[model samples]
Structure formats: structure tokens, C-alpha cells
Target: MSALEAVIPTPQVIERLPGASFKPLAPAYVRIPKPKPELQQEAIRIADLLKRNHGLDFQVAVGGTEQPGDIRLEVAPVAGVPTGKEAESYALTVQNGQLTISAPRMRGWYYAAQTLTQILLRSPEVPACRIRDWAAYPIRSLHVDAARKYFPKSWFIRQIDRLATLKINQLQWHFSENEGFRLESKKHPEILSKSYISRQEATEIIAYAQDNHVEIVPAFDMPGHLGWLLRNHPEFRAGEGEYLTRMLDYSNPVAVAFLKELIDEFSSLFIGQTQTWMVGGDEVFPMEWIPKELAKRTPQLSEYAKRNLGPKAEVLDGYMYFLCEIDEYLRLKGFSETRAWSDLLYITNLMNLPPRMQIAYWTQWSELMPSTQKLLERGHQLLNVSDRYFYYVISNRDDCAYKKHVEATEILRNYEPQVFSEKYPSPVAQARVLGSSYAIWCDTPETEDYEQITRGIWPGMAAMSQKTWNPSVKVLDEEGFMSQLYLLAKRV
Candidate 1:
């Protein structure tokens, strides 16, 4: 059978004729009714995809009325759908040489369009199919840390569009860090001016991400990794002491106010009823730095640390104080999620946190699985972003892993059932395991060959996605799965 026949096999020919004359469907004509901004955009995108893949011509129309066509879309509005609803609730009926999709909201319409697109992509000869699908995870997400290395706005938008195609609904944008801050914060102009390439570039990227089905969750690394911010505003530092490169002074109310204002500006720009802010509370090193700074300014700190934490515990005591203060400030401003590397959980008393607060466990070390178990036992939600499974940067480049001399091929080989069985499946893991994310750390992924990076990561990440989506799915036969990947790549 030919490629077209293989994708769209005819039951009658298979049963009786063995080989029969068959003609594929003609170029599709799509008519969109009551098209809103999002629905229209989705329809256009679907049309473009069809044209690119199958040489199908789509004639699109928008109104409250109906027209004779191969496919018809009716877009309407609904009330009960959650905030930032991007799809419509549509009913599709195909009969008598025409297909129709009717929905009450733009989100529903967008969803219906996506279903149609998938059907067409999967089978060119089949013009009709029925599907009723919505997102399983309410907060389907992707997290990209631009602070480690900045990706251009166009590149960011391309990633967003690709995720939207896969039905992934959110983009957690790590916008600021010690290495660089990418967003245009109103309170701190110097954040982008001193750190990023340009502020206009950041805004344009935000707009592009929004245009796709992804919501951008802006993260600003605070307290521990605020060195870049402090470099610009020396007054924000805890002490005259030059360890300012390491930590911020939470004892200073001025510094607290700075964070509050930064969050407020982020809320105005990105956060919404459905989307939330991620104040990164991870990788806070040199715990003693803050207490020492406070010791010089406030003579009481020395006595306080000695009395409460004992002499040896002074550093940790000070770090915990900073974490608590930052968490409180974010809560006051209506932020819901706070992400930190797994190490933070072991060192900090994060149990009994506010209900709005959610933690992201970035598995950097082997101990992260145990830390995740501990946090889950304390009744907290977590996003699993393990470097072994999800770090895309590591998979892409040969230079990233010197210890193993691992290339993409080696990374893919190492990611078989052995790794999953031995390392990933800790004792007490469950569905509260919200999802898995592959980190595209900017350091290694600086080149234009992002497609190769994506290829190396996807097959392995697909295993992770299956594990997160359905734990019962077995990790057997890597060769079989790799063959599937090659077939999928050829089709695309």
C-alpha cells in the first residue's frame, strides 16, 4: 500500500477486494461561523497546517450564518467554563457531504478546530470523525528558564505554538535570575536594561506566547539569587559587606517592598485568575550570609541566632527566616505557586505552607526523589522536573555531560527501562505528581540546531509523559518506540 493508503485504509477493500481502485478526498473547504479572535486564529492555523502537509486548500468564512462547505464551524460563548478560557464547547455533526462544528464559546470552538486538525493530519482520505476531548490537566504546563540563557522572542513563540499543537496549555516562563533578568519590570528598569538584550523584545515575546494557547507564568528568583538585581541597586543589599553577590537582606523592609512591587508588576502583566506567578525559592546557598549582614546592622541578631539556633545553626536559621518572609510577601500579593530546587525542601520548614502555595521539585541531585516523597507526605502538590529525564539541554549536547562522555544517542540509550525502574519510581509516588517537564537550560542550547536538540529530548520525554499521564503504562521495548519515532518524524 502507498503512504496515503496506509494512513487511511479502506475496510471494504481489505475485507473483500484485496486491492480495489480508491481515490483520496478532495481539497477541504473550511467555513468558520461567528468567529472570535481565538477561534479564527485556531482555524487559520489548522488550515495552514493542512495546506502544508496534504496540499489541501481551505476556504474560511466568519459570521453568525451558515454556508455550503466540506467543514463548517459555529463559534459561540458559554458562561461556566473557567477563567482565561481559550476554547469553545462545540458539537460537530457530519452528514450529507458536509461537516459542522457548533460551540457556545471561543474556547470550545478552538478545541473543536484542534480535533479536526488532528483527524485530518492523521488521515487524509477520511474527511469525517467525532471527538469530544478537553485537557486532562487543568494547568497543562511548560517551563523554560530564559535567565540561564535568553531565547529570542520568535523562538519562544515557535515553542509556544508547538506546545499548543500538542494540547499543552501553559508556559511557565522563568524570566529572571542571577545570570540574567529578561522581563521589563516597571519597579526595576535596570533588570532588563542591565541583564537582557532588550525590554521591547521581552514584551513582544509575552504577547506572542499569549496569542498561542499558552499562558506565561513569570518567575523572578528572589533572596538567594538576587545578585543581578542587587548589582544595579546596591541599596537593596543587606549590608555594606560585599557578599552582596550571594544573598538579599530579607530583614530589610526596603528589600521586601522591592520584591512585593516586582510581584505586583508581574501580576499586572502576566498573572490572571487561571494563570499564577512562580516566585523561585530554590538553590539559596551561603545561608550564613544574611545573618552576618543582619548581625552588623542589628546587634540583636547575634544574640537571637545564638539563643534560638545555637552557634552552629546560625546560617540555616537565617536562611529559613528569609524563605518565610519571601513566602509571606508573595501570599499577600495573591500569588499561588512558589518553585524551588529539591534541596530547598530538605533545609527549609516548608510544611504547613499557605493553601495557595505549590512547590516544584527540580530534581538536580539523586536525593530529590526522597525529598519529593517527604513533600508529598506533607500534603503539598509538586511538578516533577528531573534532570535525568527532563533536562533537554543535557540530552542535546555532547559537552554537557563530561562525566559519562554522553551524546544524544548515549542519553537515549541510558533512558531505557533500567533507568526508570532503578531511579525514577520512588516508594510513595502518585497522581498528585501533577506532570513532568523537560528543562531547556540556555547554556547548552545556544545554537540554531534546536530541532536536533528537540529530537534527542522528545523520544525520552515521551516516555516521561506516558509515565506521568498513566503510571500503569510499561516501559518495554525501546527499539519498538524508537521505530515509532522515526515514522512520526517522517510524517511531520
Candidate 2:
């Protein structure tokens, strides 16, 4: 096999050179010419990775010119490449017994370090090659349902480092769900009745993620998936039915106000850290129980619809009204965009939804849900978290376990950010896609421990890193991919 093929999320350009492999000599240094703090951090990280993986003795020497056998990190324009200045793009060249990593931005330098580490993992001697690589999508991400499973802060920190190595830039922490609320809330201390991630720990996780060139997209799913919150304040519940209790009562002014405050309390914590907030809008009243629950709502819902939606608005319009209120509130809290699942079926017109909202097109399980093509044509940007391709549902049930295994092979062969359905084989233009993500929904939290969860997701996550980084590239079959993945796998 070509040594270049060992690199995951394959580079856009690879040119093999005629020379001996460049192996780092002992007492080598990761030479950083510039004294920028960020560059220093990158140099330290690269040096540590080399030490851990290859047992090479390397030191991070800041403010130095490159010497022989030195791994150099530089922040400068990548010459000769016409489109080299994009975000997270990097060029790596090994020649003249030295390895140099160059990019125009911090993230590019970080990714170049990752590519270098991956190549070195296959063998201590680096192949003589030049690789120019960049991500096709800007928001390559992974959504973890910690709300259900309650992973510790260390778990998130570990995963962020792992993800950064694969060039996955975003980690969406789904910290709220019907079963549990994983974030500590001082305002509502009772919500921390279950295992939770505290405020200080979350801050640490965010800092760690940023250091590793990863952004933490905090997801506090609202309106729906409110079982844990409603359990403490049942007055805010829409209905007493089994499923209805999971949803917030949008009709009640007091309830909506309470939720807005709740959102403000937690969202304010993440204000400076992240610009995007995910207000999960999936699997609400779009199913057969819509009418049954609609009738349960007091006359306040109708009043809310008429006043906020329109004079002739129906009960279902309440969803859009509640979403808009939350969206507007998030904007006030300094969020530039809100992300949600594509279950806004009650929205009669596209103009009614928030302009800054990006849709996570996860499912077409509901016939009433809008088609992926329709949503794109109507000018909504989408992140394809297609359930068929990307969901890793960990449950004890036979069907759920089957789904976890079934999609593993399928994703390796055919999944990509633009793919939502097999029926619509034509992919949407890259301009309309923000990127894609693999989702780990722990429907049954106790079914597996954190180690088990990581093991379960390893293969799928490996496949996803490749697919999201460059969706159109040729992929290895399941067996080939897994073999290469195991050879390249390093937990740290």
C-alpha cells in the first residue's frame, strides 16, 4: 500500500518524493520561529504527541530557525497552491532530512500537526511526501448525548483530543434530554438530581477543546425533551400523558417565561465560548398524537397562536411561536446562530422560522416532516445527521443494537454530508451544506459504560472523520478501513 493512504481524511494533494524516509533524530526540537502563544501551544502539543506515540525525545523550542531533522511549525501563506488560504487548510512537506508544516492560520498549523502525527503512527520514519489538505465542510462535528448517559468531563476532554486528531472541529455536547439534565444548574439545583457535569468542569472542557483546535457546541434541547426539567416543575408541562410530559407547555406565559430564564441561565455560561446554540426541535407534536395533545392545551395556546402567529393561526402554530421566542432570546444572549432538528412541520411558511437557524436534517421518519431538498431549496442550510448513516443508538433492545451495527458498514461505503436519503441520490451543492455529524444517542444509558460507548463508536467515528473531511473521496471497504484504523488508533 502507498504510505500516503495511511493518512485518514485523505489529503487533497499528495506528491511522493525520491529520497530516504525522514526519521527524527534523538534530541530533536519542535522549532517554532514565532513566539505567538497559540503557536507555542501547537509546538508543545506536537512535541508531546511525538514523544508519546513514537518514543522520540523532542523538545518544544520557541523562537528558533529550523535545524536538520527539526519539525517546524510556521504560520505563513502556503506558496504555489491557488486555494491554500481556506480555514483549517494545511500543507506538509518532508524533504532534505527535515519536516516542515505550514499554513496561513492557527487551525491549519494544528491540522498539519495531526496529519504528521498520523503518518508517524504508521512508522517512525516519515515517508517523503507533500500533502495539501483541507476540509470540504467547515463544521465537521460529532453530537454526543451526554444528557442520557452522563459522561464525565474527562470523557469529553479525552474525546475532544481524539476528535481533533481526525480533524473533526466541532463537538456538540447534547447535555439535556427527557431522561436527564447533565449540566449543573445553580438556579434550579433540583435538575441536578442525576449524574451531571458541573459549571467549572464544563469551563475546563471548553478550554481544553479550544486548545486542541475544537469548538464545543453546547446543546440544551428545549421545548421538547423536557422530562427532567418538568419533573421538578410539573406546572410547566403541556400534558400529563407519557409522551406529553416530555414537552414544555408553550401556551402558558409563566411556563414560557420560566423556560426563557432557564435558557438564559445556562446559555449565558456559554456566551463567549460558542456562537452557535442547538435548541433541539425534533420529535415533538408532529406525530399521531398531535390532535390529542392539542386538545389538552388550554385556551391560552389558541390565544398565543392568534396573537403571535396570525389571526387565523391553528393550535399547531404554537411550535413556531415558541421557537421564535427562544431564537430571539438566544440572539439577545449573543448567539449568532441556533441549530435544531428539522421537525418544524407546523411552520406554514419558511419566513416564520428564525433567519439564523440552521437545520440538522436527521430524520424523515415522520411523513409530515419537510423533505431535505425542499428545505435546501427554500434557503435553509442543513447539517446532514441522517439517522440511517450517522446515528449510533446504544440501547439494550435488539432493534437498536442492530441499527448500531448495520449502519457501520453502510457509512463506510456510502455516507457523506450531502446524503439525506437514498431515494434522492443527487447530493445538494456544497454551498448549501454546513457539514455533517455522527450522533451517539444513549437511549438506554445503563446499557454500557463510558469505555463501552467509546469502543462502540470507534469504527463509525473513524468512518465519519473521513466522510465529513472530504465527502467525495473514495473510501475503503469496512474490513480495510477497520484494519487501517486499528493500526492508526491512539487514544490520546
Candidate 3:
């Protein structure tokens, strides 16, 4: 025997003991010990998957049964589930021809289902074993730039399922950029498109994500990536000429208010019991003021900007102040967790920033461990996306951003958690890491090669999932990972 094995993000513990094993799942009926609406729906989804993959009539049973095809689910906390950190831990025991999964939370049970589904694909039979598993980071996020380019509705839902199988619990919805805003709002009817997700469709996507154990963290990059929005509403744009730059005019109070209104709309749709919001404060390299040198003359604006913000009240300072105001406003409007690019902390002089807003540290090909350490020192939690490692590339090189082709395997192996661990060895340092989210940016919506993109998402996403789930993890067996990938493809 090749020893007891599990798929990507190999389990924490797997012990084999001599006993009767399930030769096959045995025409099983999946049952829940108690009525859990979420648990029942997840069980049904996985059972339906098993039926499709292996031609097994794995019926979904709501309550316990002693019949032959019995796979009972029990809910309870893992003996030592972490209190301070979010825990997605579960225990599965297969003994005496019965398989039972126990979890402390609904998410745990759903993850346990994913693990078992993979095991089934390898063999209908499971050795008499006990497996205990939990995620290393509370947030394993995947970022999709639907703002720059849009994807089909089915694409997002299928992606939710695929990400869940890899145990990614969050989807960072980057739905606004310079190219387009891929959401429909009655207030902003001018920007609506045939391809945009309607209000009704957005609601459906949210529901689908919840059922599949995923949280959608929605984002609309402000101030900078607003070419499309500013083009439509030229009064809000920063620079002017026959060829006006697309950046939003930060010194323009009307423009600042316009961005806030968009945030209000974004919050109304995304904020529920558990959604998060982010304002992108990245790549504001050019210092563009609407009036060119308005701050140099306006004492009131420059005084507030200089006093509350840093001392040097320049164009960039105004931009930072504007972002901080929006951040605080979103926080006041019930978004306790506001996120922005780590550049807000690294490059800008924006002081008295909302310390509570989580930072997503991503910069291409630059060593950000120091930046992450800096953020941690200031008591800020961060998600280590570190763009170079998590970015996905299209084969055709047809997108506006990336014109060169990159392999999915390279993207998969580009990152490791060791860098951060080595940099910050203390317990406090460890906890400040929110988790990692890989970005798959698409700048041109029209010319995407679906096959190439889908292939990249599967194995590459699997690699990211495994690394973030267990930061110390490495590809020990190439063949084993490939085998796992094949099975995962069937489910995806």
C-alpha cells in the first residue's frame, strides 16, 4: 500500500488501525445528526457530486438512519479549537464500516465533505483511519479582477465551488477598475452593460457562495483605477487636456463625495452578516491635482490636510487624506473591517489612518516581508498576496495588463510561507498574518481563452490553497499532486 493519503493540503493527522474498512462507500446515504440548513445543503451538493463522478446513488438523508448506506455527520468542536483565531477544523473517523465526520462549525463540516470527496475519487474504499485537519490561516482568499474585465455569472459560481474544494474561504471581488465597473446599480445606470451582473444576479451569487462555504469580500479600487468612471463623469477626473488622464481628482470635493456615494452603494449590496469591504490605495505615483496647484492657495483645505494628514500637503497628500476619509467613513457605516493596499502604509505619508482596516500586502517582484513586518509592528493584520507569487497569466497574451505568457506551474511554486515565518518568529507576528490571496487579473474581457484560464485556476489555485493552508507545505511528490489535480478537475 502507498500508505494512507489525502489530497492537496494533506491532513494534519491520519492514523491507520487494523479493522474492517469500507471497500466502497456502499450505496450510501449521507445523513446529518441534527437538522442544519447549511449542513444539509452542503451534504446534498457533495452527494450529488459523488453520484456524477462515480455513478453512485449517494442519496441525501436529513436525519440519522441505521440502514446499510449510512454516513452520519456529527457536529462538535475539535478538542482544542483556537479561540482567538477563526477555526475551520474537523475530525473524520472511518471505523467498523461506518464513516462519521465531526466539526465544530458549519464550515468545518463542509471542508470535511471536500476532503472525503477527494478520497472517494481515489478509491471508493477508505482504510480504517482517523483524520484530523484544520486550516493554518483563517482567511484563504482568491482575487479576481472582474472590474478590469468581466466573467460570466456561471464562471463566478463555478469558481466558488472550485475554491471551496481547495478550502479557500474568501473571494475578493475586484469588480471596479479603470476599464469598467462590472456591477449593476440603479443609481449608476449609465455604466450598466449587457455583461454586468444585475442586482438580482449579484444576490444569487452571494447566496451560492454562502452555501458553498465562501465569503465574498467585495472591492472597488478608488481614486486611481477610475478611468471608466471618470470618463463618463468628466467633472470628477483629475487631469485635463485634449487627452485627460483617468485618475479621479482628489482635490475636488465633488469627486471625493462621488467616490463615497459609490462606496455607499457598494456597502448596501455587499454588507451582510459577514462581508468585508476594501478601497484600493495602490499605485498613486502621479501627483495630479484638478487645479494643478489648488492646495498651494487653499489654506482651509491644505490646513486640514496638513494637520490631520502629514505636514507636507501636496497633491499626493490630498489623495491620501481622501482615501483615509473614505476608509473611516466605510468603517463608521458598519464595515468594521476595511482593507486597502499595503502601499498606504509603505509609500504614503498618510497619518492617523484607520488602524483597524486590514492591509493586503501585494507588490510585484519586490521583497515585502519587511513591509509585512512593519505592518505587524504597528498592530495591523495583513493578507500576504505579494502579487508576483499569486498572479495568474493568460497564454494568448491578449490582456491589456500582461502581454507575456507564464506557466501555471511557475505561478504555483513561486511562493512559500517560510519567508514570513523567518522574518517574524514571535507569536504576535504569526497571528497578524490574515492569510494569502492569489490574484488572477483580467484586463481585456473580450479575448480571454477559457481553456487556458480554467487550467490555470485549477492546479495553480490548488497549489496556492495548499501553501496557504499549511504554510510550511512543499510539493513532496509531483506524481501524487498531479493525481490529486486530475480528480479535482473532475469536480471542477
The candidate that wins on TM-score is: 2
Please estimate how well model 1 matches the true structure, expressed as its whole-model Cα lDDT: 0.52
Q: List the pairs of residues colliding in candidate 2.
A: none
Which portions of model 1 show Cα errors greater than 4 Å?
A: 1-69, 73-122, 127-129, 132-136, 185-187, 193-199, 234-244, 286-328, 331-334, 346-351, 364-370, 394-431, 443-492
Candidate 3 regions exceeding 4 Å error are 1-4, 23-27, 36-39, 59-65, 80-86, 241-244, 287-304, 307-315, 344-350, 364-370, 395-414, 418-428, 444-447
Give the TM-score of each candidate.
Answer: 0.69, 0.93, 0.86
Q: Is candidate 2 or candidate 3 better by TM-score?
A: 2
What is candidate 1's TM-score against the reference? 0.69
Q: How accurate is candidate 3 locally (lDDT)?
A: 0.69
Better of 2 and 3 by lDDT: 2
Candidate that would win on lDDT: 2
Position 312, candidate 1: lDDT: 55
Model 3, position 321: C-alpha lDDT score: 71
Prediction 2 global C-alpha lDDT: 0.77
In order, the Cα lDDT scores of the candidates are 0.52, 0.77, 0.69
> Which candidate model has the greater TM-score, 1 or 3?
3
Q: Where is model 2 more than 4 Å wrong at Cα?
A: 63-65, 79-85, 290-299, 398-402, 422-425, 477-480
Worst 10 residues of 3 by lDDT: 418-427
